[model samples]
Target: MAHLRDQPAGVDGITIDWDAPIRVSDGTVLRADVFRPTEPGDYPVILAMGPYGKGLHLADGYPANWRRMHEAYPEVAHGSTGRYQNWEMADPEKWVPDGYVCVRVDSRGSGRSPGFLDVLTALQARDLYECIEWAGQQEWSNGKVGLLGISYFAANQWQVAALRPPHLAAICVWEGFADHYREGARHGGIACEFVKGAQARQMFTVQYGMGSRGPTDRNTGRPVAGDVDLDDDVLRQNRRDLYAELLARPVNGEFYQERSADLSRIEVPLLSAGNWGGMGLHTRGNVEGFLAAGSELKWLEMHGDTHFNPFYNDRGLGLQKQFFGTFLKGEQNGWLDRPPVELLVRHPGERFEPRFEQEWPIARTEWTEFHLCPETMELRTSPGASGTLSYQPEHEDLRFRLPPAGHDREFTGPAAAKLRISSATADADLFLSLRLYDPQGTEVTFIGSNDPKVPIALGWLRASHRRLDTDRSEPYRPVHSHDSIELLVPGEPVDVDIEIWPTSIVVPAGYVLELGIGGRDYSNQGTEIENAMYPTTGVGPFIHTDPEDRPAEIFGGAVTLHFGPDVTSYLLLPAIPAP
Candidate 1:
C-alpha cells in the first residue's frame, strides 16, 4: 500500500530509498539510489545511468570538481546537506522534495552492481532502455521517465532514446558529445590522447574489480565503489578495456554509428543545452542534436564559464526544473510561450549578456569572408595577389593575422576554412587554430571542458579523409565523411574544407582575429595555470599524441598553402550583425 511518511533527517514530508535493486530483462541487477516522496503515489522519474559508481558522492569522488564549483557558486550546495550529491547525477535531496523521483544507476559493472563493464557500447545502451521500462513499472512511478545528466550520463540519453522506449518522455542533453568518433576518439582524423588519459583518471579509479579501487570517504566509511568484494581475475575479465577499444577503431561507420545518437530515431521532446567554452567535446554535439534531431518539440540553451557550475547552480537548476516540469509533470507553465533559443553572449572578462532568439545563427547572420595572403600574412576580404608559403611538416606553423574589426562584432556560430594545399607525402594532417588577440597582444582564451586555456576555436583534417558529406554539411560547417582515406598525390594541390566547431564571442573593436595553419598543435607562451584535472597545456589532454595513429613517416613531410583569386582560399565565419 502507498503510504506517506517523513524522515527526521530529510526535509519535511520527503522520503528517500537508498540502494534499490532494479533488475534488467537479462536478470542482471543494477543498483539505483531512488529519491521520492514518502507519500505513496505515482510520480515521474528522472533517470541518470553512467559507469560512475552510484555510491560515489560528488564531494568525495570528485573533490576538485566539487570544490571548484562550490568556490565559484556556493548556493548550489547551499539549501541541502548535499550528502546525496553524486558526480554528474542529480542530488536526490533536491529532487525528492519537489515531488519527483530521481534514480541514479551505476551501469553493469560499476559501484555495487556486478556485471561486465562495457562503456558506451550498444549492450550498455540496451541495459539503459530496460532500466527506463523498469522505472516506469515501479510502484512509485507515474509511468513517465525522463533522462538528464552531464557527459557520460547525457551521452547515453542520445543512444537509449533512439530506441524510442515507450515510457521515455523527455531528455535534457547537457554538455554531452553525440558522435563517438569525430567528437570523441578522433578529432577530425587524429586520435585524441585525452581518451586514454581520461580512462586512467576517471574510469580506472572506480572500475569494479577484486578490491574497491576507490578511496574510503571520510564522512562515510564505505569506499566510493562500495564495500563490495569480488574475485580479482573474474573482475578483470568482465571490464572491457575502454582505451584499447578506442584505438582499434580508425574509421567511423557501424561501430561509431552504434554509439552515436541517431537523431532520426529520437522523437521525444528534448532540451539541448551546451556550453560556449566546451569547444572540443560538448558544444558541437549539443548544437548538432538541436539542429538535426527528429524531435519536433525542442529548445536550445547555451552558457559559458565552468561546465560543472551551471548544471547544479540556481541559474541552471531553475531552467532545468522548468524544462522537466512542463514535460514530466505536464505542468501548464507557459514553457512553450517564450523564444525557443536562449544564449549567453560572451565578452571579455567572463561576462555574458543574456539574450533570447527565435533561431540559432540568428536569421540576420552576415556570412563574412577573410582571405589569406600568404606573403604578407594578412587576412583581408579582397584578394591582393597570388602567394605561396611552404614549410617542413615538422617545422613552425604558418600564421596569418586579420585586421581588427572596426566595431564591436559578434562571431557566434560554426566556422569553416578552405585550404589549397599539396604535400610531398601521400598524406598530411592540417591542424587549424582560430584565435583572437586583445589590443595589447595577449591571447584571448576560455575554459574548455577540461582545459582552462582553450583558444577561441580549433579544427583538424587529414588530406586523406577530406571527402565532405555534402548532404549533411553547410557552407560554414563542412561535414567530413571520415569513412575512407582519399590519400594525396605527391606534389599535387587539393582543396580541403575543414569544419571549425561552433563558437561564441563578442570581439571588441581593437581585437584582431588570427588563424594558424599548422602541422602540429598550437602552443602558447603563457604560464600554464595549475588545475585539478590536468596541468595547463596550450590545449587540454585532448592533444593527439598516439604514435600509431600519426606515423612520422606518413604524416611528416613538406606542405604548402596557396591563396589568391584563382585559388580563393578563405575562412567562412557566421557573423551576427549588431542589432
Candidate 2:
C-alpha cells in the first residue's frame, strides 16, 4: 500500500494504512483507510463508516463540491496537505495533524470490500458495530472510539449507536436523518426523487458491478476494488434495488424500522449537530435525536449552511472536537458546562450569529399561530374572509403573510401547520414553507442542504400520513405515526397537522413572515448553481413526482383550503422572545 503525508521536513506527518482489514462478526472483510500521526502512540479513534468509497478523493469524485468548498472557505487549505480529503467523510488532512486517528471504512461490497451491498440496512449497522469493536482492539487505538462525519457517514452513527457497541464512546451525528421513511426516502408518504438521484451519482460510481472494475486510488497505487468483477447475474444479486425496495414499503413499517434508529436505545454521549438549511433530509433527525435520545450527557448544535461546510470548518469542528475530546480522550474540557442547545440564528445575506440556549423551543417561545385568510391572502392573528382556495399539483399555490411591518423577532425551533383542507381526488400531497420577506414584498430565501435558493423551512405530508400519536405529538412539533395510511374521503374537509421541520430565522422589523402552501417545491426565479453530483436547483433532487408514488389519477387533482370558525387553519411558529 502507498502512504501519503509526505513533503516538507520538520512538519508532523501522517501514517496512512491503505486497505486495512476490518472483519465483521459474520466474517465479511470490509476495507478502510487509516490516517494517524506518524509518531503515534495509541490515539483515540474517530471513525466514519458508510458506503462512500474511502479511496476516492473529494476533488476527483465530487469536483463541484471541491470547487465550491475551497472558494467559500479558503482557510480549509491552511497548515496541511490536501491529499487526504475524502467526500463526506472526516478529512485526514485536518484530523491527522490534530493527533486524532481518523478511519474511513468502505462498507461491504463497496470500494475494496467484498460482499453484498445494501445500504442503511440492519446488516450494515451490525457490520458497523463490529468494526467499532475491532477498532477499539487495534494496537494503535486507545480503546475509545467516536463516530463523526456528514450525511451518510453521520446517518449511520444513529443506527450503530443503537446497537450499543461497547467501544462506541461518543457520536457527533452531523446533519443526519433518524427516520428512514419519513425524513429520508419518503416524506409524508410521497417518494423523494433524491433517493434515486443520489444513489446513481454517488453509489453507482463505486458499486461492484459486472463487467466493470472500479478506479484505482492514486495515493495507494492499488485498484480500489482489486479487480473485483463477477458475472452480471452475480453482481445484480449482490447489489440492492434501492429505489424499488423503498417503493415497496410505501409506509413506515418493518422495512423502515429496520433502518431507523430507536433514539431511546442510543445511550452514548451524544453531540447531534444540525444544519438549519438542511430541511429536506438532515434537519429533522438532529432535532428529534437530541430530544429523544436516552443519553444523559447530550448536546445539540444547529448551524447554517450548505450541508458540508460546517463539518470541516472552524465552527463545526470546534464543537465536534470538544464533544469527542471529553468523552473519547477523557479530557475534562469545559464541554459539559456549555449550554445544551447551541443555535446559529440565521439572518439575511447568509448571516448566522451564534446563540446559546438551555433548551430547544427556547423556554420563552410564544407558540403563535397565523390564521389563513383566503380573500386578502393575509396571515392574520384573527380569522378574516372565510373562503376556500383551489390548488392544482405543481400548477398553482396560495400564499399568506403577516402585515407589511412588524416587530423584529426571532422564530426558532420547530413549526407546524393545521390545515382545514379537502382534495378533489382521494389523496393530495401537502408542501408547506415558512418564508421571510422584505418590506417591499421581495421573497427572502436561504441556502438549504443541496439547494441554493431554498425557503426558510419546508414540510411535506401526504394526506394519508396525517395521523398523529398523542403521546409523542407536541404543539409546534407534531409527530406523525406513519404506521398506516388514513385516506381522505372524497370532498370531505379534514384537519391535517403538517409538522414543519425545525428552523431559525431572525426577522428584521418592518420585514414580514409568510407561509406558502404549494402542490410542488417552491421554485426560485433566480439562477441555479451547477454541482457535479446534483442539479443545483431550489429543491435539489428531492422532487416528489414519482409516477408510482404520485400516480396521475391520485395526485393530479384540485385541493381546497377552508377557513372559518369550525374549520380553523393556522401556522404554528415558535416565536422566541428577544432577550
**Which predicted model would earn the best TM-score?**
2
Off by over 4 Å in 1: 1-14, 217-221, 226-233, 525-531
Query: How accurate locally, in lDDT, is each candidate?
Result: 0.81, 0.82
Residue-wise C-alpha lDDT for candidate 1, range 1-579, written one tens digit per residue? 122122343444555565578888788888777778877889999999887777667876677778878888989877688877888877777777788999888888876567887788888899899999989999999999999999889888989999899999999999988898888878887777776877666765676653455765343345656566666677668787766876787777787787887888899999988987776687889888888889989999988876688899898888888889999999988887868799898887788998999998678889998888776888878775787888876678888898886799788888999989998888988889888889999888876666666788888888898999999888888999899888888889999999998888898999987899988876675344424666556576677767788787888888988776788788888889887
- Shift in Å, residue 242, candidate 2: 1.5
- Highest-lDDT candidate: 2
How far in Å is the alpha carbon of 188 misplaced in model 2? 1.2
Native-vs-model 1 lDDT?
A: 0.81
Q: Any residue pairs clashing in model 2, and if so which? A: none
TM-score for candidate 2: 0.96
